[model samples]
Target: MARGCLLAGARLVDPAAGRDGAFDVRIAGDRVAEVAPSLDPAGAGVVDCRGLVLAPGFVDLHTHLREPGREDEETVESGSRAAALGGYTAVCAMANSEPVADSGAVVEQVWTLGRAAGLVDVFPVGAITVGLAGRALAELGEMAGSAARVGFFSDDGRCLQDSGLMRRALEYARVFDAIVANHAEDSALAEGWQMNEGEVSSVLGLAGLPAEAEEVIVARDLALARLTGARLHVPHVSTAGTVELIRVAKRRGVRVTAEATPHHLTLTEEAARGYDPVFKVAPPLRAREDVEALRAGLADGTIDCVATDHAPHAPEEKDREWDAAPCGMLGLETALAVLLTELVPGHLALARLVEAMSAAPARARALADHGGPVAAGRPANLVVFDPEALWTVDAAGLASRSRNTPFGGRELRGKVVHTIHDGRFTVRDGRVADGKG
Candidate 1:
């Protein structure tokens, strides 16, 4: 479980290296020492990954690690464990904790917690608005310059609805060299909305949140990014219209990037038919057309990367009636399996999946020592998993403190058997391992 380990006979899918073949990857100290057709194990511990896929460790752009408060939902430690088990080596923690990661003090606290956990690299995302009220801006420069050095700012759970405030935030982001990630939901258009506005909502007699709510914000933010010259990131881009907006905006030379959640790419609004609160999520799942569009975007490089949007809510919060339940689902533990099951098999190539899950998101967040090419001089962060392994989801078996996963009881292909972070084994043989101590 230490740095001197060799992974042999695995199909190395390194999109950054543009290679997909059987290669032996060697880890020395904290960097990838060698990668070739054959490597000398010498005195290193060898892991025989004959039928597995070895790729660079993944990076998630959006994750809600409920720390500082609401630890019952998820903490940095628990979320890190879940992410490691799912093959992620770094994750950008969203700024929606109880006290709110609006200040340098709180973000630094979260950053230190991740260091102590010794799992994935947790990037603390500073809040864009004070207390997420959206009217006034938080101390952006202060948070950016603090010990955490937060580079991503967002009010993820709430949208900064004021156009003027949104524009100002973007302008400041340009000055600070940071990203302004929008939740992309227009409050006025989505007021009291329960699910996606479509035939299903009509049949169920439920108030629907029109896809326009998401698209409108995306369109406005694209223009705002263009006008202010700030880097804009759209989180959990739902609906076909929103995807189209991002596609067109990128073509028009807007400095914009977007991410699609696993649920949005795989599941649809049809899951709401049973009135199960587990299916309830903010920016509710859209129709099959939207799901297809999301998959296409990921395939065509229109969508930058796949982020879990790994929101965790307490049992009591999500166990209520559909209308009263909190809108979220656990994701950190199942993201890779879900994507491999849904996106692979002729729809997308293995290299493209590695790009969407690893390289793109890592470069987007500017996380160092991640998104590897599986070669010399790069930090050794990798995942080894059987591409054809099948398993059923079990909530009780998951590593998260909360069990709100909508994927529970679903069978999935692909399973992580080993995860390496910075040349140390955080998970091995489908179990958590600690080499730091």
Candidate 2:
């Protein structure tokens, strides 16, 4: 399975290059040696992929593989398997570990674990602040020069609200072209907030987190980014005002990019009516009008990409009452299918889907080896799937250690049949291949 592979008759959709056509892609060793029609197998393992779509391996800018502390919830091994099964070749691991990846040694430990897992390339993100306390800055220079070569930094579970601190971090990151990713919530405004601030929270008798809690921070960060001329990435955009802010920022030449999770695009405040903890996420889902704005933002290229903030929590932790449970959901396994079911045919095209899920994330995170056209000399990280296949999600069947998927038991269309990572099959026939490299 580590040898080269021949993917024949699949429609290649490479949004990065704007190419789409039926082709046979031949991978030799760790590079794409050739791509054309009716190529000779040449002793390679051949896969019949007719009626399937071959695209670049997906890149996730936001993922929480809770290793180094919360192994019972998720580890590098378990989360990498889940990502591979979901057709991802690379994932940016957040620095919110117990010890926090604020230094070279800690970040390298996470990177080494990813290499040992042999499922996906895990790039460790350094912390923007020491211990994510939003007080002092972390060892950005040390991490950037570490073996991990960390290019992204964040205090994702928290925000860098001190305008002076944020300005310094962005100014420092600007030197290396590293991005400062923000979780985008004003802590004081969102204090004790349970869900979206509207009729739903009033009726449910829960404290509301007003939409301004998120919008105000985004607006502030965009202005800071303009001042520093630094690349800023906003994660989990959930409000109409936030989208408009990003739209305006980009229009006015402010360097900013944003991601919308699968749940935000598909769910609404009504899902929280039943007090289901699974629907509770950071920057809680918004009302229908906000959802429509998100969709439009994505469609019109205002929102750059779709990132699975694939946060996993232990059963005991997630099964609690609504207010006590953590705010997140399992997303890597269901993101694409959920988007296909929610946006295709009416709102989005297949090419746009590839762009948002693959190309844009790679560009946003500066992952050079991922999100490319199927061509000679490129890294052979690719995914092949039956775009028309239908399936259902069973939480127990997922590859992650935690069963916290919000889409459990829901029927979904579009199935990933095979995933080729680094010129080999990590997933074949809709199942994981040998995990040991």
Error of 1 at 381 (Å): 1.2
Instruction: Show model 1 residue runs off by greater than 4 Å.
Output: 435-437
Those runs of model 2 whose alpha carbons end farther than 4 Å from true positions after fitting are: 435-437
Cα displacement (Å) at residue 118, model 2 = 1.0
Candidate 2, lDDT over the whole model: 0.90
User: Model 2 over residues 334-358: C-alpha lDDT tens digits?
Assistant: 8888988889868888888888888
lDDT of 1 by residue, 168-226 (tens): 98898888779999888888888888899999999988899999999998899999999
RMSD of each: 1.4, 1.3
lDDT value, residue 131 of candidate 2: 94
